[model samples]
Target: MTASVANDDGPQGLRRGAVGFGGVLFQSITFMAPAIATALSIPLGISYAGGATPLAVILALVACLIAANSIGQLSTHLPSAGSFYTFVSHGIHPKVGFLVAWGFLLGVIVGGPFLALQMGFVVAGTLNAEWGWSNDTWWIWTVLVCVLVFALGYRGITASTRAGLVLGAFEILVFVGISVTLIFQAGSDNTLQVFGTHYANNPDYQGFSGVIAASVFTILAFIGFEQAAPIAEEAHEPRRTVPRAILVSCLAIGAFYILNTYASAVAFGPAKMIGFTADDSNPWQNILARDAWGGIGFLLVFLALVNSIIANQNAANNSSTRTMFAMGRIRLLPPEFGRLNPFGSPMLALCAQLAVSLAVALFLGFHYDPVTGFGLTATILVDIFAPMYILLNVACLMYFWRFRRDEFNVVRHGVLPILGALAFVPAFFAGAGIPAFSFITALPKPLWYAGPIAGIWMVIGVIYLIVLNGRDPDRILETKRVFDEA
Candidate 1:
C-alpha cells in the first residue's frame, strides 16, 4: 500500500481482518440503517406533507445516488483512509479539503455522545416499562455504552465491522418483520393511497416549499449511506466494494423506508397521522404499538429502538476515530494521534473520540432532563455534521467534473448534483432556521443547528490551520502536495 506520512509512521494500515463483502454490507446496514431515525422518518415524512414523504425520499434518493456515483468515481481512483476529505481535497482544492476533514471530524465526535445518549433513552424507557426500574440515572448507562464502543473501536476496524454486522443484521430482521406485519394488516387500499399523490392534495400545505420542508427531515432516514466511503480503506476491493456497497445500501434503505413509511401512513390513516405530533414521546413507536402489534408489538419496537441506539453509537465511534486518525496522519494534529495499537487500531484517536463524548454526556446529563439532554446533544451533533453532508454532495459534483471527465455529462454530474443541492440546501437552511424559530416561539430549542454551528466549527478549523501553517510552513506544503499530485 502506498503510504502518505508527514512525521512518524502513521497508524498501521487496516489490519488484515476477516471482514468481507457480507461484513461490510452488514456494517453499512446496521450502523447506518437501524436507528430510530429510520423508524421515525415515517412520521417525520407525514409531518412534512402527509403523504409526500415517500416522494421526498425518492427525490432525495435520486439526488444522493448521483452524488454517490460521483463519490464512487473518486473511490475507484483513490481509495484512502481519509474518505471524503481526502477525495475532496484531491479533487478540488486543499483548503476545501481541510474544511471537509474538520467538518466531518466534528460531526463524528459530537455524534458519538448523541448516539450514546439516545441509546440511554431507549434503555431507560425499556427497563422502566419492563422491570420497573428508575430511569433517573440513564446517563451512567449511556456512558458505559460509549465506553464499550470506545473499547471495541480501539481493538481495530475488523472488530468494529464485525460488531456492526451482527447488530445491523438483527435490526434489519426486526424492522422487516414489523414492516411486513404492518403491511399485511393495512392491506392494499391503504398502501396505494399512502404511496399515491392524494395525500399531498391538502389545502394546508399549499406549495412545494411545505413539501420540501417535510421531505428534508425524511431525507435524514438515508444519512448513513455515506458511511461506506469513510471506511473504504478496510475493504478488500475498494474500487468495486465501496461503490457497490454505497449503491446497494442506498437502494435497499430507500426501498425499505418507502415501504415502511407507506405502511405507517396506511395503518394510521391520513387524519390520524396528521394528529400525531413531535410532542408525543416516542411518537412512531407509540403509533406502531397502538395500531399494529398491541402490547407485544410495543415491546418489540422498544427493544429495536434500544438496539438501534447501540448500533448508531458503534458506527459513530468507527467513523470518528478513523477521521481523527486520518487528520493525525496528515500532520494536522499531534503525531501521537496517528499511532496505532498493536492490533492496528487508532487507539489515541479512538480515545480522543471517547473523551469528547464523555464530556458532552456529562454536560447534557447534569443540565437537563434525560430526553431533553440527549435530544439537544444529538441535534447539535447532527447540525454540525449536516453541512458537510451537503458539502459532500457538492464535492461529488465537483469530483466527477474533474476526474471522471468522460462520464461528466450534465445529467449525471451537473443536474443530479443540482437536485441534491436543491434538496439539501433548503433543508440546511431549515435546520438552521428551526433553532431560531424555536427560540422566538419559545419552543424548546434544538441543541444545535446545522448551518451556524458547522460554520463556526469550520472557522475554528481555518484558524487552527493558519496557526499550524505559521508554525510549520514546510509541513503545510507537504500536506498540500498529498492532494496536488492527483
Candidate 2:
C-alpha cells in the first residue's frame, strides 16, 4: 500500500496511515463547522422557511444522506486522494475529471477566505471576553489566521487532523450545550411547535413554498461533509474508514442542525423573530448568544466559532492540497504540484492555495463588505460542489454498472446513486438559472453566475487538457494509469 512510490527525484510519497476513522470523521465534521453553520446559515434559512426551519433542514439532510451513501459506496472501490477526480476519470471520462478538479479547487480556494472572515468575526466578538488584539482591519486577522492555518497544513495530515479533532470536540460541545440550554429556556414554547405552520409572524414568508425554497441553503451547509472522501488514500483502512466517516458525519451534522435550528426558533419566539432576523448583524450574538447561560455565554459561542473556522480551513486545505497533488501526479497538470516536501506534505500546492486565498480575500475586502463577499463566494462553492457530487454519483453508478457487476447491488450502486443525483436537481436549478429558487438572496448585485462560471471553468480545464495532450500525446492513457494499475 505504497500511497506514492515515485523515484527520489520525482514526487516524494505522502505520509499514509496518518488519519484513521476518527481523524477523517473529526476533520470532515469540523469542515462542516456546525457552530458557524448554526450561527449564520440556519438563521438565514429560517428567514425563508419561517418557523419550519427544522423541516427544511431535515429535507436537506435526507438528500445529503442519499448523496453521501453513493460517495461512500465508491470510496471502497476507488480509494485515492483524487476523490471525485480519480473516480470520474476512471468511470466517466478523463476529460470530465479535469473539469471536476478545478471546479473543486476554486470552491475550496474561496473557503479559506470564508473561514478567515468567520474567524475575524468571532475574534471581534471576543474582545469583551478579556481578549486583546482587536484589529480595526479584519483582513489583518484574516492574514494572521491564514499564517497559522498554513503552518498547520505545513505540518502534514496527522497534525492537522489531530488539531481538528480537539478543536471540533470543543466547538461541538459548546454548540450542543447551547442548543440544550436554548431549548430548556424555551420551556413551554419548546413543544413541537417549530414543525407546525406557526410562522405567520415571520417576514415575507409564504408557508410551504418558502420552506421548499430554503432547502437550497440547508443543502449548502452540508457541502463540507464529503471532504472526507479525498483523504481516503491517506486514512488508515481507507476502504472502511472513508465510507463510515462520510455516513456518520452526515447523520451527526443533520441531527445537530435540526436540534440547533429548533432551539434557535424556540429561543427567538414568533414575536421576536421578525425584528431579530431583520438586522444584518450576527444573529447568534444579537439574539441568544449574549444571554447564553449568563453574559459570558458569548465567549463560549465566540470560542466555538473561532475554533470551527481554524479547523475548517485546515480541513479544506487538507482536501485541496491532496486533490492538487493527485491531479499533478496523474499527469493531468504540471507535476511540480505532485512533488512533496521532506515532511511529505504537498508544500508547493499548499503555498499556492494560501496565496490565492489571501489575494482573493484582499480583493473582496477592498471591493465589497464581508457579508456580501462571503455570500457570493459561498454561492460559488455551493454551485461548484453540486456538480462534483452529481458527477461522483454518476461515477459510482457507472463503476458498479460496468466494471464490477458482481459487486453491484441495485440500491447501493444503482438506485442510490440515481436518487442522489436526482436529489440535487433543485440545486442545479437553483444554481444555474430560474428566478424562483435563488439560494442566497442576501449577496450584493454581483450575483453568482453558477452555470456560466462552471461552464467557463470546464472550458478552461479542457483547453489545458488539449495543450497537455499536444505536448505528450499519451497524456490521456498516462492519466488513467492509477485506474488501470491499481
Candidate 3:
C-alpha cells in the first residue's frame, strides 16, 4: 500500500506546515466569532424560543456536529485549500464543484463586509456610549480594521492564526466569565426550567415549534466551524489536524453557546426573556455585564466585541482568499488570483477580497446605515451558506458510497449525511419565507432581497461554468485529477 502525498506539500506555495494544531483550532474558533454570536445572534433565539433558548442551542449543536462529521471525514482524504470545492469536485462532479465554489465564495466574500460593518458599528457605538466619541466615524474604523486584517493575512497563515489564537482566547474568556458571573448572580433565578418546553413562553412560537424556529439562528452562529478545512493545505499534518480542528471547534463553541444562552435567560428572568430582542440594540448582555462587575465588566465586554470582529474577519479572510487561490489555480477563476506574494500568501486574492468587501460595506453603510447594511450582508450570507452546507453533506455521502465503498458505514455516510442535510431544510425555508413553515412568522426586510440575490448568483455561476467548460475543459477536469490521484 502507498501513502498519500500530503496536501500541505503541494505546489501551491502556501507555506506548508506553517500552522499547527492550536493555530488550526483557533482559525475555526475565531471565525465563528463566539463573542459576537453570544451578544447578538444568541438573543434571536430568546424572541422565539423564549426561555427555552438553551434547548434551541443544543438542537443546533447536534445539527452542526452532524454536518461537521461529514466535513471532517472529507478533509481526511481531500485536504485541499479549496475545502468544500475540492471535496465536492472529487466526490461528485467537477461542474457541481464549480457551482459550489462560486456560491461558497459569494457567502465568504460578503462575510468580510458583514463583519467589517459589525466592527465599525460596535466600536463606534461603544465609544459614543462610553466616552462621547462620534459614532458617525464608523466608516473610518471599518477601513482601518480591513487594513489590519489584510496585513495580518498577507504576512502569512502562521501570523494570522497566531493573532487569532490570542484574540479568540481573550474573547472566549471574557464571555465565559461574564456568563458564569451572570448565572451565579442570578441566584434563585437560575433554574434548569430554561432548558424545558415549560419555559418556552413565546406566544407566536412556543414549545417544540419555538425551539425549531430558533435553531435557525443558533445554527448560523456555528457557521465558521469548518473554516479550518480551507487552511488544511497549510496545516501541519493536515489529514489529522484539520479533522480534529473542525470537530473540536464545533463541540467547544457549542458548549460555550449553551452556557451563554442559559445564563442570559436566567439573569434576565426567564419569564421576561422573550422580550430580549425588544430593543433593536439588544442591551441585555451589556446590562448584565455592567451589573456584574460595574464599569470594568462593561468595558471588557465591549472590547470583546471589537476583538471578536477583528479575529473573525481575519479567520474568514484566510478561508476566502485561500479558496479563491485554489479556484484560480485550477483556472476556474483568473490566473492572477492564484498568484502569491513573496511571503507565500495569496496576496492577490486577499487584496481583491478586501477591495470588494470595503467598497460594498462603505456603500451600504453610508446608504442605509451600518447596522442595516450589516443585517443585509448577514442575511445574504445565510442564504448562500445553507445550500452550500447541504450540498457538502450530499457530496460526503456520494464520495464514500461511490469511491470508498469498502470503508463506508451506513450510519456515518448515509444516515448522518441525510440527517445533516435535512436539518438545514426548515431553517432554509423559514429564512427564505417559503410560507410553508408557518412558524417562521415575520422576517426582516433584508431577507426579502437575500434569497433573490443568492439565486441570481447561482444562476450566474452555472452560466460561467458552462462558458469555462467550452473554453477550457481541462481546468475543470484537472480539479478531480489533482487530488483524486493523490
Candidate 4:
C-alpha cells in the first residue's frame, strides 16, 4: 500500500519503491547504452545512410517517439514488469500476451550475452589502446563482466541503480562533451548538410534504400527507453514516474544521437562520409584521440565503452529478471523464478538468466569475433522485438479506441499508435530478412538469417500458449488478473 521504498514488510517479498524517477530515468538512459552506440553504432549507421546519417537518426527518433508515446499511454494504465506483454494481454488477447512474454524473455536472456560479448572486445581494445598491451583473449573480459552483472543484480535494486547511475552519468558526460566540442570546432563548415538529401547519390550509397537500411540499425540505440517499463513496479509512484522516464529518455537519447551522428559525420567532413565509416569500428576513439585532450579523451572514451556495456547488461538484468519474476509469480514461468532472495532480489531468475548469457557469450566467443557475434545477436533480437512493438502499438489503439472509449482521445491513444505502427512497418520488414550489419558475415540460414529463427521461436511460443491455455486456464486468468490490478 505504500508509494515509497520496499521494506521487510513488503507484500510480494520483492522490494517496492526502491528508487524514484531519477533512478528509473538513469536506468532507462543507460539501457540504451548510448556511450558505446555513439562510438560503435555510429559507423554502421553512417555506412548505410552515407552522408545522411543525421537524417537517418532523425527518422529513427521520430519512429521511436511515436512508439514510445503509444507505450507511454499503455503504461499509464497497467504498470507491470511484463511491460508490453502485460499491455498486449489486457489490450488484446491472453494467448498473444503469452507469445510476447516468450519472445521478449528469449531476447533479453540472450541480450545480456549479446551486449556482453561486444564489451569483451571493448575491454581488450581499451587495454591495448590505453596501456599499449594486447589481450587476444576477449572471452576473459566477458566472463568477468558476467560475474559482476549477476553478483551486483543479486544484491538489490537500490545498489544496482546507484552503481549504474554513477557509471552511466560519467560515460554520458564524456561522450556528450566530446560530441559538442566537435560541433563547435566545425564553425562555418557545420551546416545542416548532415541532413541533406544528397547522401543517396553521394557515390557510396545504393540510393535512398541505404538510408532506409541505416535507420533500422540506429533505431536499436533507442531501445533502452522501454526498459523503464519493466521496472515500473519498483518505482516510486510508477504511473507518473514510468511514463515520464520512458518518454524523456526516448527523446533525450534521440537528441544526443542526432548531435552525435552529426558531429561524427562533421569530423569526417562532407567528402569522406562513406569512406569514414566503412569498416571502421573505433570512430569515436579515433576522433577523440586526434583532439586536444587526446590521451585523456582516449582513455575516457574507452572506459565509456566499457561502462556502456556493463550498465546495459545491468539494466537488462534488472528488466529480464523482473519480467521472469513477474512470470514466476503468476505461474507463467517456473515458480522458482518468482522466488525472491532474503535481500529482496530475484536470485533464482538472476542465476537462470546469467547462465544462459554466459553460455552464449562463450559459445560465440569461440566461434566468431565480437562484432559479428554482436551483429548476429542484434539482428535476431530486432526480429523478436519488432513484433512486440507492432503488437503493443496496435493493442493500444484497440484498448483505448475500441474497448475503453471513455479514455480514448483522437491524439494520444489513436493517432500516435497508428503513426507508430506506420513508422515501424517498413523498418520491420526491411530488417527482419537480412543481417543489416556488414560485420555479421554468416547465419545458420544464409538466405534468411532472422526470418527462420524468428519464425521458429514464434511457432514454439504459439504451441506453448495453446498448451497452457488448454491445461491451465486458471493460470491464464490469473495472468490476466495480474495486469488488471491497479
Best by TM-score: 3
Candidate 1: worst 10 consecutive residues by lDDT?
435-444
- Comparing 1 with 4 on lDDT, the higher-scoring candidate is 4
lDDT of each: 0.66, 0.76, 0.85, 0.77
Name the TM-score of candidate 2.
0.91
Regions of model 3 farther than 4 Å from truth: 1-11, 441-446, 481-486
Q: How many clashes (backbone atoms < 3 Å, residues ≥3 apart in a chain or on different chains) does model 4 have?
A: 1
Name the lDDT value of residue 325 in candidate 4.
Answer: 84
What's the C-alpha lDDT at position 183 in model 1? 73
- Per-residue lDDT over 1-486 for candidate 1, one digit per residue giving the tens place of the 0 to 100 score: 432332344444554323577666655666564447656544655665666566666666775676566666666666666776777676666667777777777777668767777767777776786689888768777888888888888776788888887777776766677777877887754645544455663455634544555666666666777677667666766667877887787778777777666666666665455555555656556666556667777777777777777777787677677677767766777767777776667778888888888887777776776677766655555565466666666776777787678867787667766666665664455455553322112224544443456678778989977876688755443333322122
lDDT for each residue of candidate 2 in 5-110, tens digit (9 for 90 to 100): 4455765566677787889998679889888888877676676777777888988898899888888887877778888777787778876776777677777677
Q: What CA RMSD would you report for each candidate?
A: 3.6, 2.9, 3.1, 3.2
In candidate 3, the residue pairs with backbone N, CA or C atoms under 3 Å apart (3 or more residues apart, or in different chains) clash, namely none
Runs of candidate 1 exceeding 4 Å displacement:
1-11, 16-18, 129-131, 201-203, 206-209, 277-280, 287-294, 434-452, 473-486
Local error of candidate 2 at 241, Å? Answer: 0.3
Of candidate 3, the 10-residue stretch with the lowest lDDT total is 1-10
Prediction 4 TM-score vs. true:
0.92
